[model samples]
Target: MVMNKALLAAVALATTMIIMMARPSVQESVYITNHLTKRVLIVHCRSTDTDLGAHAVAVGASFHWNFRENIFGGTFFWCKLAVEDKRIYFLAYDEYVETFGTWFVCDDGVYGTPASRPAFLKAAWTRP
Candidate 1:
């Protein structure tokens, strides 16, 4: 009976581990930084299923949020960015590729950066 109990406990532990591993990340995070010079960068993000709301990031500061993904499929987040009169859009996250972490940013802090980089990041935020 003791041997049987040990065996059952081992099985339960193995099954719990498997379930935990198989499940998608319960909490994932994304970060956005404002590389714009002396400008308050405006960031608004959303998924097909969720609206992450808008944020105003001070220069040299970073904005971030956390959430779970739809592990089944089509898990992605997109963002809208603006500085002064110029505004653009970009992809903040793609679960399939895990394209970036703390993205939509540059240390350069130059205007018209988006024009050169395919708007927002293409493969990044600012999708076509």
Candidate 2:
């Protein structure tokens, strides 16, 4: 009986670990843009050694296309954070990208700024 219990416990533990590892991680960053409202919100996670950053970590994310009577457009997204540490947020319009281009962003704070790549950071928000 003792040996049976031990084996069962081990199996249960292994199953739990496998399930946990199989789950998709949270997004290291997220960006949202309202077509009708023309409002944009970018949330970036920390990539450095510090986790105190107020941004959301982009372990996973999604982007969707929105259409309305007056507005029709699609959002851009990074979805995944390469560094898996630092995240930055920004708010701007589509024209911001045309003006700045890819080299516009200098740091996390500059990521979504007027000079940043606005087209690449648009992401869809998932409802809880």
Candidate 3:
């Protein structure tokens, strides 16, 4: 009986590890930074049909968000920034790619132009 219990326990442990390894990982994130010297940035992030809401990021501050692909096999996010009562908008779309991982938004003192691109950091860490 003791030997049988040990074998069963080993099998269960092996099965659990295999299942964990075979599962698809979800690691996605969006990072937005306000690089303005004095202006506060009010950002609105949303999908095509759903409104995810808005966030206020102070100067030199950053915002990070984690998201998954939509049920339609793609993900689209539009961001609008309000600075000094002026509104500027940008869009990030991912259809073939799995995740965006990280992005950066910076103001270069150019009106109506906010520099946006992927970050230099590594991809987002995965979770079980």
Candidate 4:
């Protein structure tokens, strides 16, 4: 009876460990879209002092990044967008330790100003 109880306890512990290991870790994703009429948008994305490179998105196009495998420990990211001969910069910062999902939109011809900020969009509006 004692041996059976010991085996049961060991099985329970192993099962708990397996469950914990199988659980997925927290991750983050960002989506950027260009909603301009006749202008091309260039985007640069970076996090935690790492440069994730740049992209040129045409009107009505978009760019997306998933940080599931490469988790960023910081709570913020920096980005810049170029419109024609002008450039616009912005930063996405959150007080939360981990940002699950967020998105930005470059609408019309409003960006490329010194005081410009990317238009924050709801998760539902993330898709192009």
Candidate 5:
């Protein structure tokens, strides 16, 4: 009886570890292409809590890219999101701030970027 109980406890512990390892991980895929060098760099990020745009703007206020530490300015960028209780939508940036366009996921499974250009630092600050 003692040996049987010990074996059952060991089996349960093994099962739990297996379940944890098999869990899927959520990650962000980032890349940069340099036409001059004809090089493309890629990065994968995993965070339990997803950061939204308003959060990003606040973080951006004190943002500085630490390339020496392998952190990019873009990593500090958080999406300005328009979300409902059940769903979320991504907006794009232009030379100035314009609330137009929608974003979708690409075949690669990462969030798609807006077709418009990057929003200016100046314009983003003034907008409500």
Candidate 6:
């Protein structure tokens, strides 16, 4: 009886660990779509810990990245999208809350997806 109880407890612990390890999903990602009329989009993104570098996205293409949120919280990513001299900025992700968005729309300028409904930062470019 003692041996049986020990085996049962070991089995239970293994099951619990397996269930925790098999969680459906914990990773998160962001997608950036270019909706520009006819221009290539220059995209660059960064976080407190990493820079995604610059990418030239075709008029109808997209760029994306996947990452786990900071374990200690306070994960964030921001991006810049430029078309010719026009540019805009938006947060790609925010861990603390609904602070930023994961889906972005790049038309004449950049914006978080309509579902996000966040105020925007658009810049009209000129020689500086």
Regions more than 4 Å wrong, model 1: 1-21, 104-128
Q: Residue 34 error for model 2, in Å?
A: 14
Q: Write the candidate numbers in order of decreasing lDDT.
A: 6, 1, 3, 4, 2, 5
Question: Of the pair 1 and 3, which is ahead by lDDT?
Answer: 1
Off by over 4 Å in 2: 1-3, 30-128
Q: Would you give me the overall lDDT of model 4?
A: 0.58
Model 2 lDDT, residue 47, Cα: 22
- Candidate 4: tens digits of C-alpha lDDT, residues 1-128: 25788899999999887876675565656667677667777889777656879898877877777654332223566777676666655564342443324444545232222224444333221211
lDDT of 1 by residue, 55-128 (tens): 88997888888888775567888888867666676667788873555664543322222222443334323323
Higher-lDDT candidate of 2 and 5: 2
Residue-wise C-alpha lDDT for candidate 5, range 77-118, written one tens digit per residue: 233222122122223222134322222322122143334665
Q: Candidate 5 or 6, higher TM-score?
A: 6
Name the 10 consecutive residues with the lowest summed lDDT in model 4: 119-128
Error of 1 at 8 (Å): 28
Instruction: State in Å the error of residue 3, model 6.
Output: 36
Against the hidden true structure, what lDDT does model 5 obtain?
Answer: 0.29
- Judge candidate 6 against the unseen true structure and give its global Cα lDDT, from 0 to 1: 0.70
TM-score of every model? 0.63, 0.22, 0.56, 0.54, 0.23, 0.64
Task: List per-prediction Cα lDDT, in the order shown.
Answer: 0.68, 0.32, 0.60, 0.58, 0.29, 0.70
Q: Tens-digit lDDT track for model 6 on 1-119? A: 25788899999999887876665446887888777787788889999989999999887788998888665457888888777766667667777655444444545345554353654
Displacement of residue 86 (Cα, Å) in model 1 is 1.3
Q: Determine the C-alpha RMSD for candidate 2 after optimal superposition of all C-alphas.
A: 16.7
- Predicted structure with the largest lDDT when compared to the true one: 6
- Of candidate 3, the 10-residue stretch with the lowest lDDT total is 119-128
Off by over 4 Å in 3: 1-25, 97-101, 109-128
Report how far residue 7 has shifted in candidate 6, in Å.
Answer: 31
Residue 106 accuracy (lDDT) in model 1:
45
